[model samples]
Target: MLAKARQSLRAACDQLNIHPDVYEELKWPRETLAATLLIRMDDGSRRAFKAWRCRYNDRRGPTKGGIRFHPNVSLDEIETLAFWMTFKCAVANLPFGGGKGGVCVNTKELSQTELERLSRAYIEAFAPFVGPDRDILAPDMYTNGIVIAWMADEYSSITGQASPSALTGKPLAFGGTVGRVDATARGGYHALRHLEKSLEIDPDNSKVAIQGFGNVGYHCAKLLHADGYTIVGISDSSGGIYDEKGFDPLAVMQHKHETGSVQGAKGHGKTRNITNAELLELDCDVLVPAALERQITLENCDRIKARVILELANGPVAPTADRKLTEEGHIIIPDILANSGGVTVSHLEWVQNRSGYYWDASEVADHLKKTMERETQAIWALHNEMSLSMREAAYIHGLRRIAESVEARGTQAYFDGA
Candidate 1:
């Protein structure tokens, strides 16, 4: 993942004519932290879990990212994720940098009590490293608002005061924003909406295949469906469901909730249960890979049938696939820009927490729509001007801002003498 991320940055840097020093700095993280978390399990035996946090770049402002809990978590993955967040924040025009944290554990195996203890234990170990003015952690995979609230509570307990601003993605009773749950998808929807006209996609007739049926994928598919787009394919970790005619996303969700996965969701006459990879290659007008990283690569890039790809997952398309997809004339809305809605609203939650004021969901949505549209336009404009791929344009847009910030500080390199 880190290699692919650096490769993407290098591609952008090559076009930007960036200084070697700046390019090197952008390729590596500022700090990567690892912790051994000892937590007492329900069985009363203490277990050690591997935890990691990476602050990639703070040239823009205090770093912000999500804390994930998964069995596959690793320092390398977290570091690369943080690197993407650094660019993701800047691409969205947010006044924050990038940070990421995660713990290695099978969250499905833990009870609620054990989960709470683990979440709080994570904060207790990293309290000094996180704050509103420092690295702020939100919810990611296998983590949610309650987990965020637990971490925030732990941070407050450690500091002897309320620290709502120390984190975002908490339950509304704590400090989470109204539109946050759907913000990631909504933001991608708004950004993707702008490309519809230029890409000549008619939502009323176009087919969209979503690779992940999680929060971001589910919401994006739902929103696109509501906006008159035909959602012909949707998938979860277990498998996917496909039909030539559109399927009701919410109904599929309901079926999945009743069963164990969407694979059981009954499809119409031309229905089939497909693997995650097969879902990506479905013949559709738009493909939204809201799943994990490296879904699109050179191995499968040639099989991608979608005219437009909305990346709601970080690093969904490998750097090698970028050139392949581009050569095939596919338009990709990079994850940094496409899935930035979550962090954008995270900033909103921070604002409301600091000011002790909250906006209605509509107000938040309006601001988000406008913000994503504006930022999307900037990258789109750049892509047109330079004939660069969407991902490269996004990196350049972010790198330029970060370069200005680094130069303004003038606390490091003296080559430019800013």
Candidate 2:
């Protein structure tokens, strides 16, 4: 995945005839660390889990990204995510680079005590390389506030200082921001609002279908639905539900909360049960792939009919599908920009934590809206000025920022000399 991602990014730069040195610098991560986390289970059994942290670059500032825990976690995957984070932070104009960590373990298989021990062990192994000024970690797939709080506490205890800024996405009681829970979706909402104007999308007449009913997808559906966009379909890991007259977002959320899926939600329009793949190809004005990566590929790209594709999930569209979709006139809001809200709000949380001050939910929302709108406008302007695809424009915009930083810091010499 990391190799593929690097090739895709370099291909974009090559198409623009960017400097070879710049492309070379962007092809590899600045640092990659792999560690084995040893923990003793409650049953008196000892186990070791493979974990990795990849800091793609810090040309902008400190590295920042999420730490995920799952059975499929691998160094290549973490490197790919970290590479995306570097560009995502750049697109959002955050003073940070990209870094990501993950452990290959299913938390569900561990007892509560074992989980805590594993979290602390993972932190202990990576402590020397992570800090508020080095690499800041946040929650990612299969990792949440509880795990973040544990890691933060362990780090603080080991270092003998209360460094809340060392981590974001913590519990509110532990210096987390009030609006952090829904920041990703809310940030995407702001981007979508700007998208509506830039793309000339009619909100009232637009139909949206979201895949994945997790934190980002659920909130995106609610916000867009409240803003008068018709939410025609929604899905989870199981299946999808669709309605032509538009299903109620709130009702679907409530039903999902109760019944664990959107399949049985009460709706009047033409209803049908569909798979996630079918949901992606549905005839909707907007399609938001909020699940995992690689959902849209050449095999399925031809079936996508949406006018706009909002990638709420990381790498939801494969590189091959990117060109196909663009050729078909589908304006894809790339993941880096579309899903940057989480980190944007995480930055806000770090600010509040360091200053010992906090903002109301409305204030946070306002800041998020302004930042997202500004970034989206800049990207769109570049796209129009250069007559570039949105993806290319986004890459150029972000890569230029990072390249400028590299040049200013004289790090370009590293690539030039190499």
Candidate 3:
């Protein structure tokens, strides 16, 4: 995954005439730590889970990223995510380098007590390596606010002091900032709305199909639906539902809550159960892939009909398929820029933790709106100026910032007095 992701960096560097030393430094992670977490199960059995943490780079500031709990977690996946986070923070112009952590375990199988124990055990193993000034952790994948609270409490216990700054995404009573729950989706929404005129999209006539009904996906659907767009299709991990006449986001969500799937949700027209693959190919103006990586690949890129794709999930489109889609004139708002709101607000949470002051939801929303617009406009302008894909433009924008930081530390040319 990391190897494939590097193609974008190389292209950006080549376009910018960047120094070789910058590419050399960015190609490898600065440090990665691995450990096994042993937890006693509820039924009097003990299990061991493999885990890893990687700080890809820290030239900008302390490393920042999330810890995910999934059965497929591996060293390669963790480091690749950290690599993307490094670029993501740079693109948002946040003072953070990329870091990510995860444990190889199915969170669904664990009871609440067992989950808490595992969360704390993760901190116990990595406490010495993490700090507010070193690597700050947040929630990701199967990890949520309660899990983060447990980790923060463990960190405080280990350090013999209140250390809320060591983690973000905590519960409200602790250190979490307001407006964080929907930040990721909100960021993408702001970007898409900002470009509506340029993209020739009218919410009144546009249709949207979304894959993945998780936190980010549902919020994206709700915000867009409220703004007058027609939601024609929606799906979760299990299956999908589609109707040409559109569906109400709230109603679908309520159905999901009651049934644990979107299969029977009602739409204005004939609602029918479809596979996740079918949802991606539905006729719609906008398609949001808010699911895992590589959902759109070589085999299915030709079948996609959406003129615009808002990537709320990280690396949702594969590199090869991305090239094909771009070549075919599909406008893709890349993940580094589109899905960056979570980390942008995570940075806000870090600031509040240090200052001991929190902003209201309105204030946080305003800040997020401005930041997303500024960055999105900049990348769009770059894309037009260079006749490049949005993904390329975004990478170049971020690479410029990272290259500046790398060069500031004195490259070989400076030593040779070139």
Number of the top TM-score candidate: 3
lDDT of 1 by residue, 1-418 (tens): 7876788788777888776667777888998888999989999999999998888988888999999999988888999999999999998888899999999999888999999999999998888888999898999998998999989999999999998988999999897889999999998999999888888988898999999998899999889999999888999889898998878888899998999799867655577888888999999999999988889988999999998999999878887887889888999999889999999999999999999989999999999999999999999999999998898899999988887787665534574454
Q: Tell me how far the alpha carbon of residue 38 in candidate 3 is from the true structure, in angstroms, after superposition.
A: 0.4
Q: How many backbone clashes does candidate 1 have?
A: 0
What TM-score would every model get versus the actual structure? 0.97, 0.94, 0.99
Say what the RMSD of model 2 is. Answer: 2.4
- At residue 403, candidate 1 shows an lDDT of 77
Alpha-carbon lDDT, every model: 0.90, 0.89, 0.95
* Maximum-lDDT candidate: 3
lDDT of 1: 0.90
* Candidate 3 residue lDDT tens string, 1-418: 9999888889989999999999999998999999999999999999999999999999999999999999988898899999999999999999999999999999989999999999999999999889999999999998999999999999999999999989998888988999999999999999999999999999999999999998899999999999999999999989999999999999999999999998899999999999999999999999999988889999999999999999998899999999999999999999999999999999999999999999999999999999999999999999999999999999999999989999999999999996
Question: By summed lDDT, which 10 consecutive residues of candidate 1 come out lowest?
Answer: 409-418
- In candidate 2, what are the lDDT values of residues 247-313, reduced to their tens digit? 8878888988898788988666788888999999999999999988999999999999998999899
Measured with C-alpha atoms, the lDDT of residue 222 in candidate 2 is 88
- Model 1 clash pairs? none
- The model with the greater TM-score, 1 or 3, is 3
Worst 10 residues of 2 by lDDT: 406-415
